[model samples]
Target: MMKRAEQKGVVENEAPQTSQKSKKQKTCSYGSVFGECDLHSSVDWGNLPHHVILRVFQFLPLVDRARASSVCRKWNEVFHIPDLWRRFEFELSQPATSYLKSTHPDLIQQIIKRHADHLQYVSFKVDSSTESAEAACNILSQLVNCSIKTLGLISTAKPSFMNVSKAHFASALTVVFVNSKSLSSIKIDDTPLDDPSLKVLVANNSDTLKLLKMSSCPHVSPAGILCVADQCHGLKELALNYYILSDELLLALSSEKHVDLEHLRIDVVSENPGQVEFHTIKKQSWDALVKHSPKVNIVMYFFLYEEEFDAFFREETPVTHLYFGRTVSKAMLGRIGMNCPRLIELVVCANGLQPLDDELIRIAERCKNLTAMGLGECEVTCRGFIEFVKMCGGRLTQLSIMEEVLIPDNDYSLDRLHLEVSKHLGRLWFPDMMPTW
Candidate 1:
């Protein structure tokens, strides 16, 4: 009996040992599977050496390119490549603190150092009103030596900054035009700039300046613009909004030296319209201006009264591009169509008019090369759009039906519209209404 009990004990011990071995084998198998899986899935993508990655980064916008560089250490080095930020300026989301923390100041310094020689465009805005002008000037000073082709400045009003007599104001202007040898385009808004200062800047760089835009610059007068027209013979495009524009200035623009001006925009200041009264100009003046400057291609007259438009159209002149905002009627459009047979672009924003689609269609039919058309805020239906497109055939390249027509929900109408326009249309814009691409 004792021998049998001892044998039983030994058997039980062996069974437990076998069970332990099985558990150990299962654990090992799991570990091996996991190890192999990780080895296969884990990859060092950043370590891959290829110029394609840098090229891809170049294709991305400035902000995205910067983010991509922040992914890893090697990428950060790649972001510092001088050529990446040469053509564009980058602004970080955070204020100066975060920018200093994350990015190397040397990179920014290098950008500023090589400004005019390498940079093409710049967009800058300041967060604090009190600090805006000074901060903006500081940034501009850094690019003084840059051959910047385009500069856009946007700012807000603080009583402190509103006083233009401050030293910061002159400093900003000086820095902007200091060494802009190759500068061609400049746009400024809501800042204090006087006529004399503007003349000085234009006279300094008059040879290279091609396009100039000044908006809400209360101090700019017709005389200042004439200074530009007289000095900058190479000027091709000009947009002035909420400034003083007079018939005398228009007459100056018609001079032989400034006749090369192809695109012109003049927005009258409602409060100061008395300074440049549209109704006061004689019909003969308009005719003389057109006769003197036959090369003017695009003309925009904003906030003009109906009588002023009548005077303008009474003159027999050829207009290739015309935009009449708030003062055009169906009868006026028809008169314009009869006068300008070579009209290639027309923008009409006449509101509260009965459907003038019939007149528009007639104008489209007459203007054979009508490539772009903008019917702003006028009441028109999809049927009018269809007929207009049909009338233009393949000549219409850009069509903007803003604030009026409703695109159908189904694909049939959209498809038909697309089919009609696909042959010649390069861009079709409809506000708040998405038609199938």
Candidate 2:
């Protein structure tokens, strides 16, 4: 019995030893396999050509490029390049508001510090929430100290905290004007600017400002606009909305020497000229403005209570682009084609079409440079479209017809129209069903 027990213990000990040896062999094989896989799978960061990597980064959006830099140690080193930062700034400003909102404040400051010397354009919005007025002022101060040329300020949000007297909002504005020596264009939205405020802005930076947009500013009056026209010698583009625009202001702007006005946009509610009674003085003012400023391109959005289309269409101003909305008659279209020979683009939105087919054809024939035409929510048939295309097939590159198709019978006409358009058209945009052809 003792001999049998000793033999069993010895067998048990030998079995454990054999199992341990097998387990060690398996682990070694797995380690070898894993090592080989890692060596083959690893990206050769050093072997990647510099220009190829830079081109890849250039294709990425600004935010994605920043993210790519964080992928690894080698990638993180690429962020130090100055040209990369400049390209990022350019792409970042394309979607200004969203980019500003997504980027961290600290990261923005870091970017400003690193690439401030190369900064050319900066657009930022400040609301009472998200950031304090003081913080906004600080950021603007940094940018002004930089070489930024274009500045856009949009105050979309109202004051968050009730401490209006203690707020640094005014100081922020002061900092903007004081440091913005290189600013050429300025766009301010949703802010009321009194005459005094306008004077301060113009007095400080009028000489350098080339374009100014003060849309949705309730406190801006005709006086303030005239003040800008008089003072800002280099002003080229002016956009005014919600503010009162008068004939006197237009007259003053017209008489200025070498006005250099390239673009003008005005939204006004006027009850004058050819509606009920012709305001000769206002008409003369507009005529003189257009005639005197040979280079100026005018865009007016006026709301008249009881004015005929003839009142607005009488001015034979040379416009590169024309857009008309509200209750416009088909007869007026013919008048416009006869008057504005230099018109290149026409965008019309009306309720019904009385007899504008001949007028449209005339426009296509006359305006050889006519590249785009937008007929929005108008009563237009596919047959009329086919006729227009046949006349201006070579010049018309873009035609947008929205909400015009009424009947199932028109589908066949639409199909034919699409086939004709597909031949000469390089780009086609439709709001409804996609074109079959």
Candidate 3:
């Protein structure tokens, strides 16, 4: 009987051992299915191919990418790849107001120290804070050795760059203009960019500059832009305020030595509309531009009162994209329908209570190539909008009409409007509704 008790005790001990082994086997089975296999323990993840690691790092944000470089020596090498630094945008914002986290100063220093020459397409995006603009300028000033190809200074809320001193901003920008002799595109809008800095840009980057957009630059006179047009013969796209757009500039762009311009945008804005007298571009100059570059798109944006519009659309103007920001009169839109035959897209932010039924129909008939339109703070009968849509048919690619713009007529109500519009559009269409909140 003692022997039998001993054997039973032995069986009990063995049973626990068997149960433990079963648990381990179960865990191993799960690991096999879920990629936690025993082999995973022995594999060296840090030994991944350089190209694979580089591609993964490319998708990471600046801060995260920098942290990821410390994972292994291979990743650190991938962090310094030239291709990864070719296109970079420095996002500058204040911590108090901006929801976005600013890029760490330490990382920016590391990039400037190690990869400044690798940068090609660089841009500075700053908020409304002048401090952020100052930070951007500091970085720009440090990129004296950079061979950047494309540079843009974009302000999110307001032109914070305008707050920077002209001397500080110009000196910082001159560093880039001097170093980046091959700059092909530049967009420095709403800044204190003066004539001397512009001349510096033309002197260094004229041979390679292709597109220049410096609208709302109050310090840059017409002569400054004329220098760009005269020297940068390869320029294909230009944008500037109306005050800087002169007959001489247009004629310079139309010269035989200059390349065919693809786009020209002019912003006509006045704080006190009637007080500012806008000079008109002569028909002869416009004709010369069209004769030289037949396919050029002349886009105009007008923000003026009703009386301030007398100088515009008077004759045959080649404006393709037109926008009226403030309240425009019916007579002005009538003039548009009569003169703007090459109109492709139009946006009218506000018009008076007049039902634009006749104007809508007229635009549809006259502007044959009109594909995109947005109307707001305006009145149009449902039937009139439907007729305009029918005339435009499926050719109207983008039709953004506010729901309030439509006044329900006896025939068509707002409830049934989308169905008719969708039928004509060959796709689903709905009027933009104002949010209740």
Candidate numbers sorted by lDDT from highest down: 3, 1, 2
Candidate 1 lDDT at 402 equals 54
Candidate 3 lDDT tens digits, 64-119:
55544544445566777788899988888998987655665665776688779999
TM-score of 3: 0.87
lDDT of 1 by residue, 1-437 (tens): 12322222112212122243443343233333223423234434456464656776677654445444434445555555556655664332235523211222334554565434566677654443445445556666666566667877654333323544545675677766766656688877666777867766785788888888876676777788778877787787787763455566666667777636666665543433344545434455455556765566645555665544444455444557777657466677777766667678888766454676666777777778788887765655556666777778666766776544434434336546555455435345334453458
**Decoy 1 TM-score against native:** 0.61
Q: Write the per-residue lDDT of candidate 2 for residues 1-437, one digit (tens) a residue.
A: 12322222112212122243443343233333223323334444433566666766666655455544443334444554555654222111113333334344445666667666566566555545434434545565565455556767654455421222223444455656666565678776555445666676787888788898876666677788889877777778888862455677666667656365788876544445443432322556757777767667766554543244445556555556776656566666776777676677788766464545677777877766678787765665555666677777767776776635322235445555676655546445333553569
Worst 10-residue stretch by lDDT in candidate 2? 9-18
List candidate 2 segments past 4 Å from native: 1-101, 109-119, 125-138, 141-144, 154-170, 242-259, 268-295, 300-311, 324-335, 353-355, 358-369, 381-393, 402-437
Evaluated with TM-score, which candidate comes out highest? 3
TM-score of each: 0.61, 0.62, 0.87
Error of 2 at 21 (Å): 34
| Model 1 CA deviation exceeding 4 Å by range | 1-56, 60-78, 90-120, 125-134, 154-167, 241-262, 268-276, 279-296, 304-311, 323-335, 338-342, 353-437
lDDT of 1 at 180: 69
